[model samples]
Target: MVSKVNSQTKPRSRFRSRNKLSIKEIFMWLIIIVLFVGMLKVTTLLAKTYQENQHPDSEVYGVWQEKDVAPYAAEQLIFTQDGVVFEGGVIDTNFYFDGKYLEYQHGDTLRRFKFLNKDLTEMKMLLSSGYQPVFQMSEKFQNNIR
Candidate 1:
């Protein structure tokens, strides 16, 4: 006698079927993704900062003295690869130059200086009160005083 298969009974699949992730698993995956993205952003920021610190503007990376200072006086501005150093040993690293002008953030104030000549030897500080103080490269100042 031939046996008949029942309509309600189905054959099992040979391959294991994938089940949907539970709410906890989904939340965990989301957290991991967010953390990974955050890490990548921080890494990119650090790399950019490193590159900027490594290569500063060559034209402005030296000591500059006030144009009208006395021969023996030492009123100067020092620029380094790391930052701009003031007389009192204050260093401000947040600075940028766009060829024509250099601007730096100091505490709550933003200071700017404009290049006055093509040789990049002369620059003037642009103050808000309209008092522009000229500065010359240290070497030029020394030559003039001699």
Candidate 2:
């Protein structure tokens, strides 16, 4: 009976040891995880770069003057031909021209805006502020149009 017990115990110990993780296996798994994370980062950067390269809408590109009840641009609110929008000369990196809505990114704070009206001459945007500022096309822009 004692010999039988010893044999059973020896096999159980051998099974448990086989199940244990080897050092080489652990290192291999860590390397795989690191590579996967790196690939994801690279893919995200490429996607963003591609998006930034796409041209903006002709209607959305220009200087705008701010006004009350305005749906869009002005000297106060502006979109450059590049994928850049700024209020005045202070360029805010948190803006984008999506062809539909001006995607404004205010970090952590959520704000809603609406395009009340838009045309070649004027743009009225319902800003986060209670009053809507109307942006008229710049005089320089008008002169250039002719």
Candidate 3:
């Protein structure tokens, strides 16, 4: 003969009852997920756009130098009919021509120039020591000089 335990005499559980989520919580979660996806898509598009804009094929004309053209330093000038000109202390000087401008840095100085109609339209010269003038000539002007 076992005695039966009464349900009312049993100790109540200490754990709190979890309330069901309301409509507001469900909507908020949906909105959060949507926003997260939207943000991801936007970031991906922006990255693709940035990458696409990074490389372009175009003509560039200018003079550049890897290091300062000291009076005694050996230098070479290279001109291409495609409107690219390279001038530097050494032929191996690391140089690159962007479609619209020429960029060169030596020591703490950075120089940039933009060409228009084969003539320099803008020259940005920043240096800690001396001045270097890079020139651009139109094909007509070059032929006339010759």
Candidate 4:
């Protein structure tokens, strides 16, 4: 009976044989982290923009002049930050507008105005009675409306 012993030895590399992370793996992880941070920043900016857009009181602050005034209606309106709205240039009308709509009492009817389009420089509104008007921002409206 002849017993055969295996004498094969594994070759050793010149460098250390450790489970080291490759350069490519490190770069990939770094890129992922950077992208995650970038997305977070973008999300924060978008949220701020949305909140600003929803604040009608802030955007509507200051005075607005009617482009084409009717003989029976006021020609100018001034909206202060304290929810006080003053209309003049003929007959004075005092009212206020919430975030969604503007409400006022005219004789027996309660009038409401809804905004259709709005920006820093211009705003368009639709009245409950199907009247639409575009009000340009007054020169006194110097806040950052964006």
Q: Highest lDDT among the candidates is held by which one? A: 1
The sequence of per-residue lDDT tens digits that candidate 4 reaches over residues 40-113 is: 99999997677557664465666665556574673455555434344533222544454556555555655455
lDDT of 3 by residue, 15-130 (tens): 32335677899999999999999999999998756644662222322332323446456333333333323343332244345545655544455555454433343333344557
TM-score of 4: 0.37
- lDDT accuracy of residue 15 in candidate 3: 30
List, residue by residue over 1-146, the lDDT tens digit for candidate 2.
Answer: 99999988999989999998999999999999999999999999987677666623445555656655334432355554433345434344446543335555445543334444544555556566777655665543322232
Question: On a 0 to 100 scale, what is the lDDT of residue 9 in model 1?
Answer: 36
Q: What is the TM-score of each candidate against the true structure?
A: 0.53, 0.54, 0.29, 0.37
Where in model 1 is the C-alpha error above 4 Å? 1-56, 71-74, 139-146
Candidate models: Cα lDDT each = 0.73, 0.57, 0.46, 0.56
> On a 0 to 100 scale, what is the lDDT of residue 61 in model 2?
53
What's the lDDT for residue 20 in model 3? 62
Each prediction's RMSD to truth: 9.0, 6.0, 10.9, 12.2
Q: Model 3 compared with the native: what TM-score?
A: 0.29
Candidate 1, run of 10 with poorest lDDT = 7-16
lDDT of 3: 0.46
